[model samples]
Target: MSLTPLNEDLGVLRFITAGSVDDGKSTLIGRLLYDSKSVLTDQLSALSRAKHKRTAGEDIDFSLLTDGLEAEREQGITIDVAYRYFATARRKFIIADTPGHEQYTRNMVTGASTAHAAIILVDATRVTEVDGQTELLAQTKRHSAIVKLLGLQHVIVAINKMDLIDFSEARFNAIRAAYLELAQRLGLQDVRFVPVSALKGDNIVFASEKMPWYQDEPLLDVLESLPVAEQDGELRFPVQLVARQDGSQADDFRGYMGRVESGAIRVGQSLRVLPSNRSATVAEIVGPSGLLDQAFAGQCVTVRLAEDVDVSRGDTFVSTESALQPSRKLGADVCWFDEEPLSPQRKYLLKQATSTVYVRVGSVDTVLDVTTLSHGTDKTTLAMNDIGAVQLSLQKPLAADTYDSHPATGSFVLIDEATHHTVAAGMIRTLAA
Candidate 1:
């Protein structure tokens, strides 16, 4: 397919780069930014003088662009999620350079949570060819599983370091076939494959002359062409705080402040306060600049209700006709982050958007085995980096949607009540009876 830049109306594309250790995830991002002229002069100068130059000769080590931490520089590996923002004439971009180590899977999850797409890099040199079959790295499977779980709109599996293997088409095809099998097992909807050498800049920003067999658009072109997933659904406005004025000149202004999570809210629109199920109307919409006739998803605004109907911080306002109802039981898929195994006996706090409630894991249904791409029902506990399905019993009813439908309201985090540390990132799969 020919390359086409996104129109200005398409908006920004938020994506993340992921793969196993030494798969060139950081290098790929660096190459994208460097070749696209997204890097500033000072940044380029710093790369030239970087103390840990992994590449030989005068070639710039592109990985240094995103590996900003001193530890990352010294170790030559990304430790935390490094985010970079740049714009092209065609589109604006936000790239999250996620760590590849299994130990840092939580960090990867944190980065992928808000991303619209993911680029998974597979090291061509690392793939083991066994009698006409290719074996992929375990981390590749894990990251792809997480992408499916997170419902990323698009996925690009870039076979990197192809230069090491003489840009062999046979090897590329073998790897692609293996990944396709895994993608099928994981039920990933949108996936594409590209052959690239991040270090050599082949098939990254431009098409690679070395690999003539690959006729598709380069990595950058594919990204620009990929549609930015729009947040579509009914109005979901979670009240973050209640804005009130007590002064005489303020005319008793009472506004519920929060970002519209999904859909749009307009003036005079009828809304229902969740949990309480009280009715109200949008009297006015206040934006950062001033009054706004309407507000859409991702915009932070204060909504003045036509009537005071017992709204407070953590309460949600939805379309009056919305089918969403308060429920105390929920079924969810979670990626455990803590070293401590999940204990159903213990109480944990579930924080979803503005609402926080005490919750208990009622049952550990199944745990995913990334190596086999299968779920094991015998597993009763989830260790760090393990993805599992669990049933939760909440102390109070919560208004939520399934993660696949509305991510902003459907996602949540589990916190250790004693340590106050986040333990697991969860996605609601079903609203239990």
Candidate 2:
């Protein structure tokens, strides 16, 4: 529960939960926190009071733990992303319990963008409910693509609510087969399906007894055992800000501060400072270690260079030989979240990493019909929750990589030029390629 210190040796994991309502997304999280002994006494009392207000004969309704908004509590459904934090001895986790309804599909894209892993809840039933009218097939297609676009290849499919369906082995298998087929088409990696009754705490932290027909490594074991990417593959450090902490002949310290999005960096290593092709050697690494000569990826550290380079927020650092090309034009996959349709005539603020630039839609080359995940050619604009491929021209250049390569640098959010509210989430495919 304490803040992660620079020297704490803590590895943080961000996870997002997506599932239909009453499928036990909230209840499972509530149980994890309560059983893990992370909930406080006062919080439990609040839960007790909340339970008293519900109609008689209803379950404890653990969804109240995350349905914080009054409108959501009134509607009895999650309407936005509710973040919760809990920890074990091994690693600390930040959970994003997002809405399951099709209307709130944008929230799933928003939460999944920052998550390292995604837990998709599925109801185990004899028949798959494909609402032909609305909110069924289209919702699934949208969510599946969002997860893939967010660069989360480690997907854990929690096939929940076995109790309602009699915990039948056949039922679990049917649902698992369908979801696996979807995963395969998306080119997901390490995709797994675990059957459990989230409301009854079956096969979540441990194995379920009601379904002796099912046998697999417990869900918690799978979560803890998933592989994390290496510390340094290709270094991409986008400068957030620059600080001149001290200046003297003996110690002239000029530090470029930013979260290391990817890859490790070492002191005395040569780096190319972008926007001003000046190259220098890393002189010092300043962090909780308090001014060293090097640091690894995923840590927030200020890097000092041997030369006083004209670097600032929105700049990027990389190996001089392998520096990424910066550009003002880009090709992207955009998920529109605004009610108004996207127009090429209007411009919006494209916030990628620490850079903010105004970008106009040069061409919406194509949009997926969504229901089919098929490309619709000759597309000009998009409506709410619409997924499409867009070409853009920016007022200023940004340093970016493809989402598949480095998520931190490749993903961006579109800000309404007037309202300043984020209206869309986008993934850069390449630098104007």
Candidate 3:
């Protein structure tokens, strides 16, 4: 009847499983959830009653657990991002199951933006041996590149459906060697390869007896062992709301409510209000339980300023020692998502944190060919799912950070004024000096 609250004490690993179509992303997640006893009895019963048949030939379709959308189930492809949360004795996990289709590459970008790790699935059957060299699928390389572009340091290349390959160690080795080359080319720092059979639960939650030669930790163990990426950066708090308590002077309070995007906040700290350039001191840190002395990243709290120095939603409270500079023009890396192509003539809404401003596409510098990891010749318009380097001119100045600096402040989304749909996701690369 109710959802279980996220256990912060247990530590959460936010990761995504992404690959080409039919690579068993949803099934892998389903196996992790089902085998780990995270699924309930009624859900299991519902699986039994489902009409969709799986190749595994059991009464239940494991993909049913994650492929909740009718369109996804019908097409047998993931179109939108499916987020699932599960926990084990050692750690809790938030898994983003992303689409594998090239048309939905933006969905992969969206899912991986906040993830600490990425499990890029590769179908063992798709591995081709050409003159003693392994050739990888384009989708696999695209997903891996996008994962790195999004700044995910920890990557797991899961070669799924190993059972189909007869659990061949040679096949796994070839794929691993080829992937290591790709990882090196992409500058991926941490990558691990694992052989899994999501359909039959091989090397998923437990070791598969079928492949005793592959002596690495199971997928669950790798996930459980990975250290949750530490949130470290300058203090940046984008105010979402300014709460005001009315009725009595005795309880009169003005609290700025927002989540700590990065760094830490504490009582009696000097805070700087961005754009407006006003300064204030932190008088109190109010949390759900009571007043606290300090708060870290990811904790949403209400902060009472020592002085009312003109603040509201869309304003940011940052560390006075180091603050972000406000700018009107920004250079960014954009992942275009709309069906309609992006052009310089179009006017859209740019939303970063709590701030939304009118913006126009200044120029298309380079359109990246994800397959080859090179820039294409097109510099005019960005097509659907195209990654491009673009310049944006904003009507109002905003305090922005480079994507490499802090993801929370560096990331933004572009909204079409007419359709109100998010047209693109952008990561700031540079701010006009």
| lDDT comparing candidate 3 with the true structure | 0.88
Deviation from native of the Cα of residue 2 in model 3, angstroms? 33
Highest TM-score, which number?
A: 1
lDDT string for model 2 (1-433, tens) is 1233334444677888886665567777776676667788888777777833343443455667777888877877788999999876657789999888877878878888778888887766423545522123445556677888777858888877788888878767767777777777776777888888766778877677787877676676566556666435677888988887566556656788998877778888898876566788898788976876566777899988888668888888988777587787889999999988898889999998898989999988888775676789877898888888999899876778887788778889999989877888999896852
Regions more than 4 Å wrong, model 3: 1-10, 56-59, 130-132, 246-252
Worst 10 residues of 2 by lDDT: 1-10
Judge candidate 2 at residue 197 and give its lDDT. Answer: 76
- Candidate 2 clashes: the total is 1
Question: Which is the leading candidate under lDDT?
Answer: 1
Return the TM-score for each candidate structure. Answer: 0.97, 0.88, 0.92
For model 1, residues 181-245, the per-residue Cα lDDT tens digits are 99988898889999999999999999999999998999988888788869988999989999878
Clashing pairs in 1: none
Q: What is the C-alpha RMSD of each candidate to the true structure, in Å?
A: 1.6, 4.6, 4.0
Model 1 CA lDDT for position 228:
80
Rate residue 240 of model 2 by lDDT: 88
lDDT (Cα, tens digit) per residue for candidate 3, span 312-393: 8888888899847788999998889999899688899999999999999999999887667788766699989888889999
C-alpha RMSD (angstroms) for model 1? 1.6
lDDT agreement with native, every candidate: 0.93, 0.77, 0.88
Better of 1 and 2 by lDDT: 1
